[model samples]
Target: MKYLMEFEPIIKKSSSLSPHTFSGLAGVCEYLAEPRSKEELAALFKTCHTNKIPFRILGNGCNLLVRSAVVPGVVVKLTNPAFCGFENLGNTVRMGAGASIFSAISFCSQNNMAGFETLIGIPGTIGGALLSNTSDKSGPISRFVRKIEVIDSLGIIQIRDKEEISFSDKGNDLRDPVILSVEFAFEIDKTESIVKRLRKAWISRKIQLPLGVPYAGKIFKNPRGLTAASLMEQGGFQKTKVGGAEICDRDSNYIVIHPNAVVEDVLRLIEQVKQGIRERFNVDLELEITIW
Candidate 1:
């Protein structure tokens, strides 16, 4: 409670988190801090560290699902212009962690830079994408990452190169509490070619995934050598529903939330799906979305 006064200028008490996420289903967090600059963020981090208070970073919230219970500690969101900057550096681009993935892809496409087309339709910020190693058929975003600036739990900043970080389908190895910025290397290409490819990728995603739906992206990661959606369909989970949450008719891998949905509805549906898949296919489905 004493620390609250230290950052009172940037902290909101007992704030609802539903509007921050794509699913629009979440409870409240004890403290929500929106620091206007890096210095303020570092100071806040240091305070939390010294006080032993738990904290988590929030991005675009496209792939997050928060529980209905009140979340204690701090939730940090980097929405200020200082943290959402974008810069073009010829063969490479420098992006603040708060920059949206759509903006990054569009910037690269307009500048005739290639390599980000594979993530055209994905939502969330650059930091969240990198943290989860977001990818499609082409590859993970880590492939283009040249380096990243991050703040460790101790509130110290460090630079990590591509070689220094390891990425996989599971996630990245960067244990830093905050990603400040990233430099991504890209190949030179014609603007028309890049835009054409981007358009194709976006259309393909819109067709396959559950677009324009009240869902929090994919609920489960594809098991090795198998797709989660196919497994769910095979398991007869298409009509499965728990409260106001139900398997998306467009894509069984996604759970659509109705107006009356609560976080418990989604959690229960996820558990049921996991249980059924485990029983039917003997495979343990891993979650892709972050549950807070």
Candidate 2:
């Protein structure tokens, strides 16, 4: 605990994590550190590693579902400009891990670069997207990734090529504790064409997703050839509700929260849907969101 004092300017003890996540329903964390630079991040990581303290990297928290129980760990948020910068190259763009997916897409569109339009409506930072292999029907973000810079659990920096990484529907194989930056290769296209594609993607997502709702993310991943939303509808979970959490009428795979919703409400609803689907269709649903 005394080590935290060394970085007092960046450390907040027993901080509420609700505002950091999209769900806005989390409890407090033992320590929330917002390191301003890579050096500070490395030092903080080293301190946590040496002290055997649990360390977690938080991005935009778009797909995170933290419980109401106090989370015991050092939650590192890369919000400083030093960790959220963007560099434009000729055909490739290097973006800091902390940069939002929307920011990256905007930069690409401005530079007349194509490919990122597929992720138009997706939230979260580039680091989280890469770690989760965030994608839709078009393709995964991994397809454009050329290299990644990361900080391992021991606070050592390393650069990994695309060949060294493997991505699946579950996520990526990179076990690094922190992603520092990502280099992406894109095609040169007209700015109008790129914007048009982005618009189309955004509209498509808006129609399918439960936007403008208090939700962490999609509750479950599509089970192979079958979509989770259709299955939930078929299982008659559209009208299901627990406390202030209910299955979104627009999309059954999402559990939207009301103003008074608690984490337990969402948890119970998830369990109910999982159990119902298992009993009716004999299919085990896997969660797409990360629960902390």
- Score candidate 1 by TM-score against the native: 0.95
**How large an RMSD does model 2 have?**
1.5
TM-scores for the candidates: 0.95, 0.95
What are the candidates' C-alpha RMSDs? 1.5, 1.5
For model 2, the run of ten residues with the poorest summed lDDT: 209-218
What is the lDDT, from 0 to 100, of the residue 252 in candidate 2? Answer: 89
Per-residue lDDT tens digits for candidate 2, residues 135-248, read 887888898999999998779888899999988776788998899999999989998898788889889889977577777576788888898999999888885889989888
Error of 2 at 268 (Å): 0.5
* lDDT minimum window of 10 residues, candidate 1: 208-217
lDDT of 1 by residue, 102-147 (tens): 9898888878789897688788899998888888878888889999
Model 2 lDDT, full chain set: 0.87
For model 2 the local lDDT of residue 171 reads 75
